[model samples]
Target: MKFEHVILGLLSWRPFSGYELAKHLEVEGRFLKNKVHLSQIYRLLSRMVDSGWVSYQVSVNDGRPDSKIYRLTASGEQVLRDWVTGPYEPSTRFQDPEFMVRFTFGGPLDHDALLRLIRTELECRRAQVARFRTRDRTITDLDPIEGVDTAMVDRVRELSHLHGAASIDAWIDWLQRMLTELGGTVPSTG
Candidate 1:
């Protein structure tokens, strides 16, 4: 997901100064972005302003620097809506922030769009589970250097594979449940 989309999503909540934006990102919006520097937020805001997607108004404080409180322009709203309603390409990393980001922003904006996003994620994760659930995880050592614990390596590899498979399966199950709640058809897991 583009960083701008994240910013747009935040703005959709309410107009915020750059500092507030940073604070929001650090707290409530952390899932969307773990760590974003203050300067980067300002820079992106400036770019959005230039693109005619964002506009800001300066607010004077009694004993502080003037703050530019940012808001989305009509163009920005359209862009955000288009992006939310557009196709979602699932990330290979099952727990990537992409799903959370899209859902947080898009789900509230449009119902059908939310269903589409969830459906896309569900299908992708289902495919991933089918592809990797029972794959052979054998590790072949070819002339390994001394001191390498081949057995330990194999155990770790198998554990990691199992962990990933289980995580994706759980995600798919949640998606199915969510689709049901949203009145979307839950596809067969076969």
Candidate 2:
């Protein structure tokens, strides 16, 4: 998802200054998988305002610099609603922030669709694990040729596979736990 959409989602909750937005990104929004630069928040906000997705009001403070408070526009709310119900593609289960952003707005979303998203994500992660295992196997089974550092290559590949495997495992664990918490049983992987 675009950074602008993330900003809109936050603003949907309430109005905030760029500083507050930055703080939200640093703390509550960390699950987003990517961090927005504090310096870039204002720049992005400017673009968002130009796009008509958001608008701001300048607020005067006593003995302090005035600040611009941002809020979602009607168009922005519609855009956010579209994003919430739009088809979700977990393109990269581990790195994508779309799921977290969707979770942030979960209160107003369909519970069944959310459950389907979790199941789809689980399938994607399982496929990732399979790919990792295949790569590891291929790395292990490679025949050494002359002047080639097959051992070093194998070691690097093994580490990469392990890292990928661990990430998928962690995601799977989290998905299962979420399912349990939602009073839904995890589907059998067998």
Could you estimate the TM-score for every candidate?
0.94, 0.79
Question: Model 1 off-target regions past 4 Å?
Answer: none
lDDT of 1 by residue, 48-121 (tens): 99999999999999888889999999999999999998888888887678788888899889989998888888
Q: Could you give candidate 2's per-residue lDDT for residues 17-55 as a string of tens digits? A: 999999988998888746778789999989888989899
- What is candidate 2's local distance difference test score? 0.79
For candidate 1, what is the lDDT? Answer: 0.87
Model 1, position 52, has a per-residue lDDT of: 94
lDDT of each: 0.87, 0.79
Candidate 2 similarity to native, TM-score: 0.79
Predicted structure with the largest lDDT when compared to the true one: 1
